[model samples]
Target: MDVQAVLKLADELVFAKTGKHLEYLEEAILRGTIQGQKYSQIAEDFHLSEGHIRDVACELWKILSDVLEENVSKANVRYILERAKFYNFSTIGNDNLTINNVNICPQTPQSPQVTQQPQETSTQPHIDLGDAPEIFRFYDRTSQLTTLENWIICDRTRLIALLGISGIGKTTLSLRLIEQIKTHFDYIIYRSLRFSPTLNATLTNLLQIFPQQADIPQNIETQISQLLNYLRQYRCLIIIDDVQMLFCSGQLAGQYKTGYEDYQLFFKLIAEVNHNSCLFINSWEKPREIAKLEVNNNYVRTLVLGSLGLAAKEILKDRKLSDEEAWETLIDTYQGNPLWLELTASTIQDLFGGSVSDFLQCDAPILDESLQAQLDQQFQRLTQQELAVMIQLAKESEPVALPDILKILQLSVSNLVNAIRSLVIRLLVEVKEEGKTTFFSLNTVMKEYVKNRYMR
Candidate 1:
């Protein structure tokens, strides 16, 4: 088989079995193998150990066997490669396989003829939000929307917390909800506390949403009280995105030694004592004080937004593989985070032969700021040893088993276990089970971020 044909078969086999395309090492081995190099010679040329070459060869056999639905050996591997040469595999590096080129291939009497058809397009109305169109586009979370609407319109719950990791669409959902229900409120305001506003600055911004008659007070407490009074008289919806910033160690309601103490009092007053409604969206754990507020059933509601479901995947059917199984695998890798999916989908379609799983498994850059911030915060919280372990996982071609991690880190079993458990709680790592073996991988978005920032 020619080098190109061998590479194509290797790519397909790797993706079909492990949801990852051939990496640099695998590609090098395939290139050398196609040039008629023996495994030992290839190992010596690459300056790798003999065992490493044998391991790669064995893995290649397994992958090809799975893709071909039959056991593959060194002898059959060449036969499979020859057969693959007759069938063109869609690949990124080669550009000659366009639809027009397919038309000129000579047809044989026994060969079935196939024609390409134009793709259908959707006419769904796109919501535009100026420079940030994605901010208003509702990707998923239908259940959260229903629950939010019920709380606002029917139950009249005054304060709601929309909590989730970054890029899970908390801010988008809040904005979409406000666009739907703003007519019901006398005033609507969206505030981003991501810059960690102080009490004076927060109150100053709040005053802009009120009428001139609602005179601003110099004192923070008085201003807040007056605002509540106005809210009681008039229906209002206030949204605070990135509330974690406001509660960070030194600012706003998060200013107390434990972060903002008075902010908790302020929220309690707004939700329990006053009639106004507020939406708080954040990436981290809710303040302990807010958890206490759950006791007051009539005042507040909390919605933890999760990944997008099957319905949302339909929105991008025209752009890529458009296959149900491929879409599901992509979603599972990204945990259905909208920003990650959108960013990944286009790239997956353009490169990697429309293999979403392969694109995800391959190292890629994170383009979303929210995802980056979440990863930064989590990494900042780790100890040096913990960070070391994380880098090991990130560098791995696949998930690492517990024993492998210990061996790689040269740490005692207990210490390794403790580090893994800590990462699990922090949502940075996830455990995958395959029979008796357990493996750990950095969560999808985080994996790329950590690998880029620390590993390489």
Candidate 2:
């Protein structure tokens, strides 16, 4: 078949499988592959990063492999598509046309046999969203949503860590994710560890969601084994929120609080073991094991959420704030956190008569009582070294390089490095990359809070 015919048939096959046409990058990768070009060549031609090109190609290949019932890769994608196209076109007039054993008819837009249907009696996927807060106004997380859907549905990632600071909306994003991908799993469960539930108790609560599980296991090991068995037997999506509550306060990030150490082993199993289920951990600070697991394993990953960018404007608009031209200034000062914006907007209404410009006229960013309390919880969790780093960063008017920080604090390199790393994990410090060097600084709200509370 010619190149156009190959591309058309490939798009059809992909649409038949995923219910969507090929995306721009996917089409680029396919076209490049058909012309026998390397990924680096494709990247250079399209003015994109080679790593991003390869990642898109990998996901595209996996999709085609599932549709064609064969291993599809950059090396053999053209051949596979040509073969499938030839078979499909030749059998168009037959009573039954099949591509890779999946029945399809080229005359129709959607094939009856290829469309996925619920197997069980209930048409809806089983969902147990216990205590998941309702997301009334979701801002633009389109890119994040797509990345997570690809990871969970396409890549089948077993374990994922959704991390961010307080008020950054980790819980909100996860809730929205459930709404988007709930149809793909047999069971979905969301639980909060805010109360610091024991591992056994958490396992029991989750197991109780399944049918035919009235009797609870007495042993912790048995409970874990049974949970794993259920995970392997059915496709499940489990989300645990407030994971930072399980860590000890006044220590480096990720140190488990007393009696919460077993959770480390449980999370490790979720990442290391073979299972169809995905366990998503949403926390202010990631578990220590995640750092090691994600480096060596493709199925394990962490997504550290940053600002909402232009989406923060929606929050301000909803609050009915004035000074449309100065909205970006307020958003930047608060670092685009939704809760922070909401609290600051309320302050503007109460004190500044809904004027953002007036709020900016202050000598420094204002941290109201509620905002300070939210930040207090985060700062109280820092170790002495982390606090020292924060104090130094708060004193700087611009982002400071690592060498300057080391010289200013007179700290051993290792100690300073670990403190900065932990602070980053906790999302307390902001990092800026300039060529080969990295600079660290605090946002306006953080700096003001530090100056008021610690550097007094």
**lDDT of the structure predicted as candidate 2:** 0.85
The alpha-carbon deviation from the true structure for residue 92 of candidate 1, after best TM-score superposition, in angstroms, is: 79
The lDDT for every candidate, in the order shown, is 0.61, 0.85
Per residue, candidate 1 scores C-alpha lDDT tens digits across 151-226 of 6644456678876666677778877886666555666667777666776677677776666675577887887777
The lowest-lDDT stretch of 10 consecutive residues in candidate 2 is 113-122
Candidate 2 stretches greater than 4 Å from native: 1-122
C-alpha TM-score for every candidate: 0.54, 0.79
Q: How well does model 1 score by local distance difference test?
A: 0.61
Q: Which ten residues in a row have the lowest lDDT in candidate 1?
A: 112-121
Model 2, span 167-216: residue lDDT tens: 89899999999988887678999999988999989998999998865577
The residue pairs found clashing in candidate 2 are none
